[model samples]
Target: MKREMKEQLRQVFDTPDTRRKEEFLQNFNYPKATYREFLFRQIGYIRKRVWGLSLVLILSAFAVCKIMKDNDATYSMVWVISSLFPLLALLASTEIARSSSFRMSELEMTTRFNLGEVLLMRMGILGLTNAFVFGIVLFSVAFKINYGCLQLGLYLSVPYLISCLGSLILMNKISSREVVYCCAGVSCFVSVFNGILANSKPMIYSDKFVFFWIVLFILLCIAIVNQGSKLIKKTEALQWN
Candidate 1:
């Protein structure tokens, strides 16, 4: 009698009509996440390793400044900061290129945010973080050296922009899986290029050539913007297909 009663209860509760269930759910209102909430939530999704490496670079910058403060190796500080900037920029690019790196572009397109929004948000967050770190480190070195903030900043930013431009170009042109290795190669190349500049053409850091650096910086900024626009369009084009 108990088993029969249990069977009757289950039969009455079990609904085979998914259409009815769907209609029931449609009648109930669900609270949606706000745009600001969604934006902030992406912060948690960013890998912890990026944050760890950023902190290490910041501390290393301080250490370099302290060690070279009393020595005649003040010029070497430029080499150190320039080399570090490429790695920092690469961190931002790697996060930006993550969808392609992991071949998740198709899945991202089906989401509410879409691939472009996701990439832009992550890039904005990481780019700002990198900019802040770069400013603090550059200002710290400025006090120990005789160069103006503008000049010291250029010395640091040029290498970073170069890495970003290179990475963006590679992401636009190369296959997904190979982009990671190419980006790494670009970062290493920019870092070594800084060393070459330091050793072979130390005078390039002089204020006399600051105008040329400014020109190169502007050109790189333009190139990066163009490359970035291309990359965004390429990803967005896939949605229609």
Candidate 2:
């Protein structure tokens, strides 16, 4: 009975003949994930702490903005909001630099998605997420304060951009886990500097120096792009090596 049962099972589940196998292989349609699909999938894989901390920052800023509105502390609102921008950069830079942070570049390179591609996707996703958060925070504060979109945008963006610029430069220079901590320190320093400027040179945010902020913003944007390109090239080099 056992022998008969084995024979029956073997007959039902027999390996395909060579001719059939060849035909099947020829006609096979391997499903490929589109860029959008892959991107959305990667979003889910991001650490929950990133999203949580971002939410915490947003809520904290809104709460402060509310209190500042009640107290009529307009400049204080900008100072509080702008200071938090570095923390956003820290979240993003840490995630992007995580590959090198833990010496996972070699293992990541061996995966289906190469290390550079993975890093690029992560950077793009985290960047867009952070930008959206920034926009919401910036506009919310702008609506309540006496500041225009351009003025508030520059006030908020310059510090965040500066942090990003510093982070990318540090990432390019250092490849160890310590780079993550250094990026954190850079962000903290930027935040502290914002406090100093708000306290000492509030005139910098005045209309007369708006042009100065604009020029600084443009320069930082250029520097960030240049550094980001270098970092990507370095990651690609690591993949080949």
Candidate 3:
């Protein structure tokens, strides 16, 4: 029985197509193509909106500050808050892309691909593309704010990237609307928390926060990947029916 089990295991591992299928499943679980398409679509969708929103917010804050002497601090606070436009843009893009792809996949149900696989591909593409865009934004912000590029990128990129991954995990389980609202709420909370900590204690070691954040990020990533893989297998089985 031991020898028979070993032989069976060897056959499973040695089969080329089996290996290929395994790889395909792995890629499908993460869905790079879908993610890329989502990212590009999102960038285009937000291009106009970000600029307009930023301008409006900045101008409104400036005007308010000039108009009210006692409210100057509040106006300045509002202006600082408005700097989260980029994060908002990302969240909006995620909603639009996921919903559009879900609808499109439903229309093409006759195709060889399964809905779960399609969704994974879309989300993987989105995650990668958004990561790239976020990196660029980080660099730009660092330069504009006169912060050290390496340090600022380390602090901001880590959380933002993790958040994007979390968004993907959330996307798989929730409707597009819920995903948008959830991302917005979480992003706001993180931003506010970070801002408060940064302003209140300049000398605080952020290492502990970074460590916990990374641990949670890894766990969430694993959960999403596992759930996505299971969904694809279930969808594949259902296709036979």
C-alpha lDDT score of every prediction, in listed order: 0.86, 0.90, 0.50
Tell me each candidate's TM-score: 0.85, 0.85, 0.47
Q: Candidate 1 lDDT, tens digit per residue, 67-89? A: 87767688998788788889998
Give the TM-score (vs. native) of candidate 2: 0.85
Off by over 4 Å in 2: 1-33
Report lDDT (Cα) of residue 218, candidate 1.
Answer: 96
Angstrom error at residue 91, model 2: 0.3
Order of candidate numbers by lDDT, starting with the best: 2, 1, 3
* Alpha-carbon shift of residue 205 in model 3 (angstroms): 6.2
lDDT of candidate 3 at residue 124, scale 0 to 100 = 57
- Positional deviation of 193 in candidate 3, in angstroms? 2.7
- Report backbone clashes per prediction: 0, 0, 9
Instruction: Specify the poorest-scoring 10-residue window by lDDT in model 1.
Output: 232-241
lDDT of 2 by residue, 160-222 (tens): 999999999999999999999999999999999999988898898899999999999999999
Residue 238 of model 2, lDDT score = 72
